[model samples]
Target: MKTNFQKNKIVEHPKESLAPKSGDKKDYTQSEFEEFIIKSGAVGSYMIFRSENEEDEMGISEL
Candidate 1:
């Protein structure tokens, strides 16, 4: 008899606050975020922001 194996994918949804809501220190610096990516072994990451004109823009940084 033969047996087959399959790998399972795990997804996590962690709640994070990017900005301080009520004078609380909950935000992280750009360098800190970059360090996190490196430590997490992520291949790449990107960010999206809205400009003053309400236009969506995408930014990518090389790690």
Candidate 2:
């Protein structure tokens, strides 16, 4: 038996209010990000977002 260990970097997603000052004021929510990942059909994709004090993670569906 063999085991493989690989480390990967996680990219953080931008929150609505965290957008740049010059950026649009559109509301960015969790669902919107999820939709984008789903529509793009990306595999092994995850999102990182900050809320309150802790970081979060979300994955796309395998459908």
Candidate 3:
């Protein structure tokens, strides 16, 4: 009973958690990023970029 849509519904990527939650406007600066990486580990899986406004430039990276 497999249809074209059902066959295409398979997850292409397992580590494809790039998108953040809606309206979750958390941001950080370069210094903050460096501080975070320093405090925590510098290993991540994926990341998202938003650099329209200087204040709005932020990202979401998996660790």
Best-matching candidate per lDDT: 3
What are the Cα lDDT values of the candidates?
Answer: 0.64, 0.63, 0.66
Query: How would you encode candidate 2's per-residue C-alpha lDDT over 1-63 as one tens digit per residue?
Result: 235687558879676555467766766788998899799876454445545634323433562
Q: Number of clashes in every candidate structure? A: 0, 0, 0
Model 1 agreement with the true structure over 2-61: per-residue lDDT tens digits: 345865587776787466478877467989988988899765354455676553344435
Question: What lDDT is obtained when candidate 3 is compared to the true structure?
Answer: 0.66
Q: Give me the candidate number with maximum TM-score.
A: 1
Would you list the clashing residue pairs of candidate 3?
Answer: none
Query: After superposition, which runs of candidate 2 have C-alpha atoms over 4 Å from their true positions?
Result: 1-27, 45-63
Model 3 residue 11 CA deviation in Å: 29
Write down the TM-score of every candidate: 0.27, 0.26, 0.25
